[model samples]
Target: MITKSDSTTIKSYLEDSSNLHGGHADKVLIPENTAELSSILIECTSKKMPVTISGGGTTTTGSRIPFGGIVVSTEKLNRIISIDKRALSCVVEAGATVDDLQSACGKEGLFYTSHPTEKNAFLGGTIATNASGARSYRYGPTRKAVKRLKMVLATGEIFELRRGEKLFTGRGVSFGLPGGRRIEVALPSYDMPNVKNAAGYFVKDDMDLIDLFIGQEGTLSVITEAELGLELKPPEIRSCFAFFKDEENSWAFAEDLKGKKEWKILSVEYFSENALKLLRRKNPNVPPASRGAIFFEEEGEEGQRYSAADRWLKFIKTRGGSVDDTWVAMNEKDAENFTSFRYAIPEAVNEIVKASGFRKFSTDIAVPGGNFLEMMRFYKDLFRDDGIRNVVFGHIGENHVHANALPVQGAELRRAESICLEFVKKGVSLGGTVSAEHGIGKIKHMYLKEMYGDKGISEMVMVKKALDPGAILGLDNIFPKELLQ
Candidate 1:
C-alpha cells in the first residue's frame, strides 16, 4: 500500500459533487489489491481510526468526503477480473470506473443498464449507493444488477456474498465469517417506500444478505469487488427530444408514455421551462417557443425505426407538443448529441452551485406514479411562492425528478435549504422517498429522519453497529457519527 500524509495531496479527496465543504483528512492510503485493503482496515479498526472509502469523487452526496479520518483510496485496485459471457456477468475490482465497465460490456455485445449519468463514477460506489439513471425507467437500479460481492468488513473479515445464498429469517440475518466466526444482526424494521429510493438501509422482510450491504452507504463494510449482471445490447435505440409549447403538455406527453405498455419506452426524462432556459445557454437549437421538453428512447428492429418515429410524432402533436421542432436521433452521432443534452443540465447546475459557494440543494424525491402530478404541482407552487432560482428535470417515468434550487447569495441559500425540507416533508407525506437515487451522505440526515422517525433511525443504527463495531467506516454518511455512540 502507498500512503500519502501530505495535506496538500490529500485535499482533493475532501469533497464530492455535492459541493459540501470543510472535509479534512490526515492522510490517504492507496491499496493495490483487496488483500491490501483488508489489511489497512484491520489496522485501522484496531487503532479505532475512522476510515472513509474513496471512489471516483463523482457522488452528488458527500459519501466519500472524509470529515476527519484516514482516507482509503481504491484508485490502484482498478482491475477487470473477468467477463463470463455465458453467465452474462462480469467481475471487477472496486476502483474500476463505470465507463470502463460499459466499454468492456459493449465489446461483448452486453450492456450495464444501471450506469449512472456520470461516466467517471466507480462501479463500487455505484453499487454502494444502488445508483440508477435514465434507462432505469425500464432496467431498474444497480441493486438489480448486483449478483455477487466480495467485501471486507470493519473487523478485517472478508466474505463473498452471492444473490440468494443467504436470506433474512424475518427481520434478522446471519453470516458465517472466516475462522469460525459468525455475525448475526437484526435487519431494521422499516417499510421502504415503493418508489425508487436510496435513503437509508434497504430493509424488507426476508431480504437477501447481500442486499444489506448494497445501499448501506459504506457504513457497513467496504466493497472490494463486485460481480454485476449484464443485459444483451439492443440492435439499435431510437431516442428523441420532444419539445412542448407548454410545461403541462410535456407532463401529459410523459404520462401518456408511462401508461402505454406497448410503447416499450426505455427512458422517459423531462425538462421544465426553467430547465430549457439552462439548456438554451449551451445549445441554441432548443426550440425558442418550447415551455418544456421530454427526452425519450425506445428499442425496435432497424426496419421499423422510421415507423416508430412517425407514431411518436403523431402522438406528440395530439398532446400539443411541437412536431416540427422535435429532435430525433436516428444515427449514432445524433444519439450521442441527445445524450449529451440530457447530461448538460446537471453539469450546468453544478456550475451554478460552485459559483454561489453553497452546497447543492436538490431534491431526489420520488412518489408513486398515481401521485406524480400532485407532487409536481407542489414543487411548482412551492418554488414559485418562494421566488427562488430553480430547475426541474429527471426520470419522469419513475415518477422521480430532481428539483434544484440555485441560491446565488447567503440569504437565498438559507431559504433554499428551508424549501428543500418542505419538499422532503411533502414527499414523505405523499408516500415517497426523501432520496430516490442519491444516498444520504453527510448531508440530508434530517430529511432521512423525516421519512423514518427516531425509532426507525435507532433500528438502522443497530444494523450499523452490528456490522461496524468499531464505527470506523464511513462516519457521518447515512447518519451522524454521534448516533453510533
Candidate 2:
C-alpha cells in the first residue's frame, strides 16, 4: 500500500513539522488508511527502523520527530466516522482536530469539554498526552471523555477497545476464538487518581481496558479512532475579570472562590508581570494597569449573577484586590474577546522566542493546595535571584502553574537549564510533579524519576516492555536509555 512515490511526498511534508530540539527526521511514511498503515508499520518493524508519530506539532516535550529513522504522521487520517447522539458519544479518526470536533458537536447543541490550548491538535496526540486544560479543574481531562478506542499495536495488529469490556487477544476480530480459546488478554492495572493526570499510562486493578491506552504516548499503540462522551453547553454564561495588586492577594481570592458553593468557576488563572506584557502585546486595548487576571464563568438563573458578582467584589475589596477592568459577556463576541486574552499567551511566547532568536523552555509543576503559596513565593524568589525573566501562569485553581523560561541562547542557555533542574528538585521536595500536562517525551525524561521514585519508574519501564517488546514506537523517547543506565 505504501508505494515509493507515497514515501517521497509524505516524507517531505512530514519534515515540515519537525521543528523540535535535536532535529527533524530524514524519512517519513504516511498511510491513508488502516490497511496501508499496517503494511508500512510492518515493513518498518521488520527493517528495525525507529518510528515516531506526530499530530499538530504542538508537543512541548519534543515527541514528534524521530531521533534516527522515520516519522509516521496521522494528519491525513482526519475523518469523523459517526455521531451516536443517543449514546452521547462520537466516533472520529485520530487526526481530526479539536476545532473540527468542537464545530461538529456545536451543530447538535452538544459540547466536547476537553479544551486543549492548541485547537489544531489532533485527537491522537491529545489521547497520547491525555491532554487537559483550564476546565480540567471541573470536567477532568481527555481520559474522562473517551469511551472507546481503535488502536494499532506495535506488532501491527489493530484492536478496538470498548469501555467495561476486555481486550481481545485471540485472532479474527472476535471476542472469543474457536478451539476453546479465551480471546481476551488482561493488562496489569493501577488505580488512576481521580484528579487530572496527563503524565503517563493510567493503570489500576479492575480498571477499564481503555485506560491503558489513554496516556501511553504511542509507546503501546497508535490510536486510529476514538469514541468520546459529550455534554450539554451551559445555558447562560458571564465572564468576570478580577485584578490583584500582588500574587498574595490574588491567591487569597482564589482560595475564597474555591469555597463558594453557588458559582461554577470554570477557570481561575494567574499571570506574572512578564506574562502581562505578552498579554498587552496580543490585545493592546486591555488596560495597562492590570497586573494579574482571573476569568470566571457563571451558569444557571439570573438571580445568582448579582450574588456571585457581589461576593467577588466584596472579597477583592477586602483583600485589597483592584479591578483594572472587567467585561461581562451576554453574547458570543464579548466572550471571544475575554477568552482571547487567556489563549494569547502561547502564541505570544512563540512570537517572542522567534524574534529573540532563542529556544523556548517551560516547566509545569503542581503542588498541594496548602503549599501552593509557599511554592509560588519560592519560584518568584528563585527567578528574581537568578535574574531570569520568564512568564508564569496556568490553572491556578488546581495549583498547577506553567513557568516559561524566556528565550535564551549560548552559555546562558546552559545556566538556565541548570536553574530549571534546581527548580525541578525543589518542586519534587515540595511534593509536586515536575511535568504536569506535558508528557515526559525526551526533554523531561531525565526528571521523571525526580517526580516519581525509582520504583515507580521501573514499573513504567516494565509496562513498556510488556506492551512493546521491540521498543519500536517512540523508542528511547519517553523513558530513554540514559535513564536506565
Q: Which stretches of model 2 miss by more than 4 angstroms?
A: 1-19, 167-195, 301-311, 481-485
Tens digits of per-residue lDDT, candidate 2, 1-485, equal 23323545644433212134455465666679987787767777777667788787777776665667677778788998877777888989999999999999888878888888788889888888888887777778898899988877666777777887864232112243222333333343333333345655565655566777887777777898999998876765566767666667667777777767666777777777677778777668555766666666655554455565666677667767554455456465676777777888877776666566655567777776777888888778878887866888788888888877764656567666776777778777777777667777767766776766566666677666655556678775567744333
Candidate 1, run of 10 with poorest lDDT? 299-308
Alpha-carbon runs more than 4 Å astray in model 1 = none
Clashes of each: 0, 4
lDDT of 1 by residue, 370-437 (tens): 89999999999999899999999999999999999998788787899999999999999999999999
- Cα RMSD for candidates in order: 0.9, 4.1
